[model samples]
Target: MQFESVSESRLSFVVCFIAAFVGCAPLLQAQTEPAAPHTFFRVKAAETLTAPVSGRLLLFLKPGSGDKEVSIDEFHPTATYVAAQEIHDLEPGEEVEVNADQLAFPKAFSELNGGLYEVQAVLDTDHNYNYAGRAPEDWISNVMALAGWKPGSTAEPELVLDHHPEEDAQRKAAYEKLKGTATADVARLEEFESPALTRFWGRPTKVRAWVILPPDYVKSGGKYPTVYWTHGFGGEIDSALVSGLRIYERMKAGKMPPMIWVMLDESCPQGTHEFADSVNDGPWGTALTAEFIPWLEKKYRMDARRDGRFVQGHSSGGWASLQLEVNYPKVFGGTWSTSPDPSDFHDFTGIDLYADHANVYHRPDGSAYPIMRDKGQVLATAEQFTRLEQVLGPYGGQMTSFDWVFSPKSVSGAPEAMFDRVTGDVDPKVVAYWQEHWDLAHVVSTHWADRGADLKGRIHVYVGTADTFYLDGAAHKFDAVLKGLGADAHFTYIPDRTHFDLYGVGDDRQGLFDEIGQQMWDVARPGKSWKNRQ
Candidate 1:
């Protein structure tokens, strides 16, 4: 299982607590605090940085020297609009020099689709853009130091990244409390007994499922056409009703057709994966289909044959849906996917293409800010960077879902390759692994003709034009590849929507639900005309 970040209420409480402990009245009040004055330093590229691809370069200061804290859009000079970091406290006549080979940036210009880039540094205090509130323009000074700082005979001032220890603790605490409370109410899981179940992975894996009987289930001995609803990353078992509460509420209230909807928690321990068959992560694909489905069929009183079963999901789940149809068509009748990740690695090259920043750091002309520099000075100690690391590190240095699934080991003796998000480069092997397994375009084409006959009229896909991620590009590629392979698949694009907006809670969500429900009905029964079947 994928876990969404902690709930908002809990995060709020945590933020308040941190502010109090850190001597800030509260996050809101602290925001109003005046920025400190400081002399600016310069950062010059030891050399002209070039993009490995076409992605833009990011030269932003990370909030606390951690990936999560960096918040990319902030701190970077180019991404000033994303979220600015605050700078504090610097006396005149003091200078801090930054070094090269430590600044992290996309290696090429194509990583983020021309988004803003930032050059970041830690600061004594989080002053953000306001650090210069009353200071003279020292743009030249700042850029020069950023290029590379040589050791001076005089003692250097202490440069430091700001820390919000109290706030971070508070947020984490709140999230834990909320998760415990919410999951406490989860429905009890039942024991499984299915012979078709070849194997079970993940050791006594937390298997819990809710079987949605047909509207007329009770009167009909619980026999009904069944559809298994799986979720994408950051999904929990209850996320269906939690995140999709609005949509489910409308469906139950008659805004859309009612059918048996069985939602399974595809959420794994680490939170997410491409849901591919990886020795690195164990056999999730096998477990999901062979074990999970068989257990559901045996436990519930319903139609157990493939003809009566359908599968669907969104985002990564959407990709899973199609995978089921293509790889296990005999087990599933039809599939509905919305905003799926790319099915082919080549297509992914066009989606959120990232540059390899590590190479840039190696250039003789490429200068970088040492990880120790804070806004433009040397850090006092490693402890300081550690403090910043906790908040800003992506995954919050918490149990990263990726590591749990892909990497599987700390810097210790683990089986797979994983990178320390902070000091390590992106593991090329891991990236390659994901590309090989997760690319649908590749899978579909390679096996299409042989299996295309089995997928006719069974695949239905939808995507939003403004997808926050790269799903749109992936969908287009998938469609093109399928069309060329003689597979019967349908594609739909919803306008005026981003990723979150498309999948978010709304009354108009019926249109989306209707699309899935209709697709399920058409494939499960294969006879009556679906109202809007394309």
Candidate 2:
């Protein structure tokens, strides 16, 4: 391109400026130069004839051009960059433009480093990106590998949502095959309307579970003890069925006890209710104990006595079972909760809510608070995790789930946030409410004077010393309070264990169940072993 005649000094100044900032794109594009081309993605549904789709449109950008699919993985410390926008009734074969001008996780689209990136698009029809996470009817695009992609200088990606996992004939056939192999009792996904919850929400609400009967339940013709188990997080009725199938397999192989396993689902739209009766999430605990338990006992050959009922779970479910045992000691015989959520408010996932000017994002020294870690390595900080959750459409992330369960209802009819979403500032009023209502350690310490006899010898908690969410610190605090009360509760911290591997003992990944089951069995049959209990 030939330049028009210009002064020699002005031409020299331009050459000098270009030389000074040759590699800097922003600085090189000075006011004197023309603006750079804008970049955006064109996402569309497949050409195969189909109805219009409605959901939150998401674009995922991974940092490499490998074969690895760029999926939604907000929990990972170095997760893929994700930007989301809500789309309504998008027709098939119709293109829609998307950019990171709205909300994105970790960083925006334009700010992403220039490199090889694997891009993908998804349409979450259920508005449950935080919970369901690409479940049934969700549309997904094939992975598009881009080379030397920069924000504005290069051509952007164009993706097609061609895959629907829910409509996959192979997946549907596989699920049916599994169900066909299992007994009717083990295969059924039990669901019933929850009266207490319905009354609270002014809408029909139902509770669900997969009640996996003992292998010889039909042959024995005898009532058996029930073990109420709950999945940690991101678990629903279908996932519960998969887990129950594993338990059924173990029971059929005679590796597990003959007790009926009730796999409860704790996930709700507001996040995991954790079966806690809450103002925001509804009366899940009340509905479970008052309505579901009685109905379950009648329909199945379960021992109706409280002593024959045991509760146990992992992670959030762990905390739920612990709360049930503490809150309604007369209903449950015992609890073998493992790797429970923060049992003590004083150390809620490493944040001291009671401390002066407490902040979830940063400590007093201005260091960021780590929310997740593995093998002593900080995986994600509080700010990063929470901010990513904010970008994930707000309902089902772990932190928002906590607010629904722990915080009181605000004037706006939403759960009063315990901490600021962006600033991480903790609210003393909310923490005070959480301590009195939800904090197991605080509730037990304060109410032990009245309910000491009932809770004695009934509470049993196990957690890893190296918990992924820094839950061990809160467990230690919970243990101290129980010890001070001279409560007969047992708190075990398995050395070098993590949240995922706590149940494993050597080659037996589920050996802990046998041990926990035996202890509960002995309580039911005072002097007999598990072999003789049935």
Pairs of residues clashing in candidate 2: none
lDDT of each: 0.46, 0.81
Model 2: per-residue lDDT, tens digit, 260-371? 8899988888778988889889888899999999999989998888899989988888999999998888889999999999999889889899999998888877678988
Per-residue error at 530 for model 1, in Å?
Answer: 10
TM-score of each: 0.54, 0.88
What is candidate 1's TM-score against the reference? Answer: 0.54
Model 1 lDDT, residue 348, Cα: 42
Model 1 stretches astray by more than 4 angstroms: 1-202, 243-251, 273-275, 349-436, 503-507, 528-534
RMSD value for candidate 1: 17.6
